[model samples]
Target: MPSRKPSASLLDSSQDDPSPEDALALAEQAEAEAEEAEAVAAAARARARAIRLRNQAAARELLAGNDTEAETSSAESTVTEQAEPTETAGAEDADEAEEKEEEATARRRRLHIPRLFWKVLASCLAIIAICALLGASGFMIWKHGQADHRRQLTAEFTAAARQSVVTLMSLDFNHVQDDVKNILDNSTGDFKKDFEAQQNDFIKLAQQSKVVTESTVNAAAVDTMSDDNAVVLIAATTRVTNTAGAQQQPRSWRVAVSLTREGGQIKLAKVEFVP
Candidate 1:
């Protein structure tokens, strides 16, 4: 048997049936899309309104200049001034632009540290230079005084050198005991160890140390110094007792003695011998 031809009713039912439910669903979908679109449009308008307010504030700040004090006071007090929609949208743009510029200027000022550092550095260097000059002057004065003292000491020693040294054969006194001492000194005069032997004789005499009429430096002949040490003698003379030890003999000598200075004090160094 031939299949029944597709009836008009069957064909109509296959087109998902012309039902009210489908129409209702389409209506609900259209309403939801309309609500979403309206929300999005409202958001866009809100953002535009915000931009407009900011630009208006910038415009006012620019055009206002230093207007009347009362006008400025009123503008500051009027909170509604910003909330009120401007007739022109320029106020919103101006506010945001000025805010960015002011922030940039503040950032520039904060980052520029080199100028302040240079100013402080210059002041410090000036102070250091002044201190150095003062220190140098003080040092120079100290050095000059020290040099003067050294030169004076050298001069004194040079003048005293000739008188502190005398012939080994000669004794400052002429007593019998001193006579024998003189003979012994003369015997060692030409001795091979003349310098050492003379010192030994003087040391023996110094041990006995008889005042022997008071002996003074007669002459000094040598100048000796080691590093900072110096020697000098100023004056010399000789006197001696005779056979009875009562009579006196006198001799005059221009003399200087070796003196060493340590820590600014003059010390007896050596008896200078004159040639």
Candidate 2:
């Protein structure tokens, strides 16, 4: 009794089938692979959700920035429009005030200038008239003073000339020394020198001739006058009584006498007979 031989299909199936331990290991490995695949899918989904949230947040921030910029621009434009009209109105008001002030100043100047000018003119005229009056009064005083001074000079010169002529011509033989001394005292310069040189001869002649003379100055006038010197023209008469005359004889004479100031006294400098 031989057992029946196994079919080929069955034998192959049995050889291909794993053992229980191998099947269990294979099933465990498959389960582990499935679990690992599920974990990888979950990681991928989490990364995609995070990326979408970040993209949405970025879009919201961009929209907010753009809205803020638009609002700022609109506000700036409104402020510029309002400020421009206000500044223009203020400038027009300033110009109107300045023009009104200038017109008022011009009207005040026109109203007051003529009165001020006439007052200044009258003051100047009064000053000028006062100066003219003072000047005329001073001139008149100076003129009168000068006339008085000239008259005093003429009188002094005339008196000196008359006295000099009288002293020169009057002589007496009885008082010959006194007569010569008087002549010398009243004279100076060339007359004194020349008369002194011929004094002895004149004295001798006067004594020998027994002369007595008397003189009178009829008139004396100053011809040319200065501060310290003067020339005078004199009309004089001399009465002579000598040995050859029975009575006194009168002689008319014209003399030009030059006078000088000597030691505060006027003296005769020179004398010339006028023919």
> What are the per-model C-alpha RMSD values against the true structure?
18.0, 26.9
Q: Best TM-score goes to which candidate?
A: 2
Model 1: per-residue lDDT, tens digit, 139-224?
99999988887667666555434322333323543253454444343332233245445655665664465435445554443345
lDDT of each: 0.54, 0.80
Q: Stretches of candidate 1 above 4 Å error?
A: 1-104, 111-113, 166-257, 260-268, 271-275
lDDT of 2 by residue, 107-215 (tens): 9999799989999999999999999999999999999999999998888889999999998999888888788888899899999999989989988988988988999
Q: TM-score for each prediction?
A: 0.35, 0.59
Model 1 TM? 0.35
- Cα error of candidate 1 at position 63, Å: 16
Query: How does candidate 2 score on lDDT?
Result: 0.80
